[model samples]
Target: MANFFDFGLTLDLLRLPFVQLALVVAVVLGLLAGVLGPLIVSRNMAFSVHGTSELAFTGGAAALLLGWDIGNGALAGAIIAALVLGLLSRRSSEYDSVIGVVLAFGLGVGVLMLYFYKGRASNKFGLLTGQIVGQDFASFALLMACAAGVFAVLAVIYRPLLFASVDPEVARARGVPVTALALVFAVLVGVATALGVRTVGALLVLALMVTPAAAACRVTASPLRATVLSVLFALVSAVGGIILSLAPGAPISAFVTAISFVIYVVCWAVGRARGLTRA
Candidate 1:
């Protein structure tokens, strides 16, 4: 058994710029995403996770095709995709179908474009599987700024957002702007997904965000409690995963995901036991 504590000590020793930035970005973004992901899952927008991630892929592809800045293309793609989902979510009836269509088409287009740009493997991998670990101070600064901005927005909207999430009909009846909340959340999620692709990769970002939160939620019914637990779990997973990956031959994604899965299983079991005891 690898000691994540000692493993973590190793990471602190090398201190590569890329690794440092990754650790910071992952910890910050993972904390925010885990805190919010459960709320999103409660609102039954799980599909939106997949949709936004695919759209992010398309954005990276476009950036590669146009030879523009990768981050710029990704942000643009994410914004456009989130707008579509936000609008569709208002209908509530056809939202799933619309999102599914968009996700599929966007993924197809991204794959095709990647095929056309065969030589841009580094960019493709960065957007797709998250291999780009090093960021200049400027990029790291921008990522931190985005993370801070997102954290602030989420904090400001937390109360109403939680109310609206648990019961949209009641919240709306109480005069909460559920529609606007949805739009804001979609945009935030879109941006977060784009940024997260840098650390967790598009494939694993949702796992980092949603899984820890889901696990925490199994143990706590109170929203605030769950949020706190979720953040804690996410931080553990990110920091632990980074530390594990620093060891001789470990993949960060696998380590992080396994930790998250373990947490989820433990929480699920505890929840089930409590339910049975109640019965």
Candidate 2:
């Protein structure tokens, strides 16, 4: 087993260019996920995120097979999945079923693609469980550019988006473009989920994209407060997980998920205690 307590090794690893790039990627993904998490929760799109992530994996696998940029492939696949889901799952009764059908198909296709790829086994593994070395300066720059676009779009539509999420009927009655907003938001979520797949993998993307926001919501009803707390929680989980994994040479997703789950549990306990006190 690798020495988990090797502080000297950890510090040395941290100074490496790849490790530094991973840290930056984690930070970007953390902030993006944090900002999007609350909106996703409020809109009841957690399952959508899961489905999108799988399609992203499929896309990445396809890219690997075709010798294309994996990040771009994943992003394209996620965006397409988001659009399909947004269109087909318009009704509440059909939402979960639509996601289930799409997710299953995507996963199957992804597996087949992986099987056909004669490249490094680690590349296939990375799509499912993240590999920090998969990131480079070029991909990192693309991620940043995408993140900036998402933020800009959100800045313009945040108020109406929040309203539509909270009360779609009222928002529609108020002349808000509810349907359009929902589609746009799904695309934004797809982008973020694709980015997260690089750090936490498609299987565990929710640790960064949903858990922090869910924890924040447990503690507060205010959207602004929830968003702020969610961002902080996600940052801690992502960065801390990366740092902790360095010494052990373990999978980063494991650490990220554990930290996120712990935060959720703590928030749940506090919320329950507050409820009991109020009663």
Each prediction's TM-score against the native? Answer: 0.90, 0.98
How far residue 164's Cα lies from its native spot in candidate 1, in Å, is 0.8
lDDT of 1 by residue, 13-48 (tens): 448776777777777877777777888778877778
Tens digits of lDDT, candidate 2, 1-279: 547778899999999999999999999988998999999999888999999999999998899899999999899989999999999988989999999999999999999999999999988887888877888988999899999999999999999999999999999999999999999999999999998887788899988999999999999999999999999999999998889888887778888999999999999999999999999
Worst 10 residues of 2 by lDDT: 1-10
> For residue 244, what is the lDDT in candidate 2?
85
Candidate 2 residue pairs that clash: none
Error of 1 at 132 (Å): 5.2
lDDT of each: 0.78, 0.93
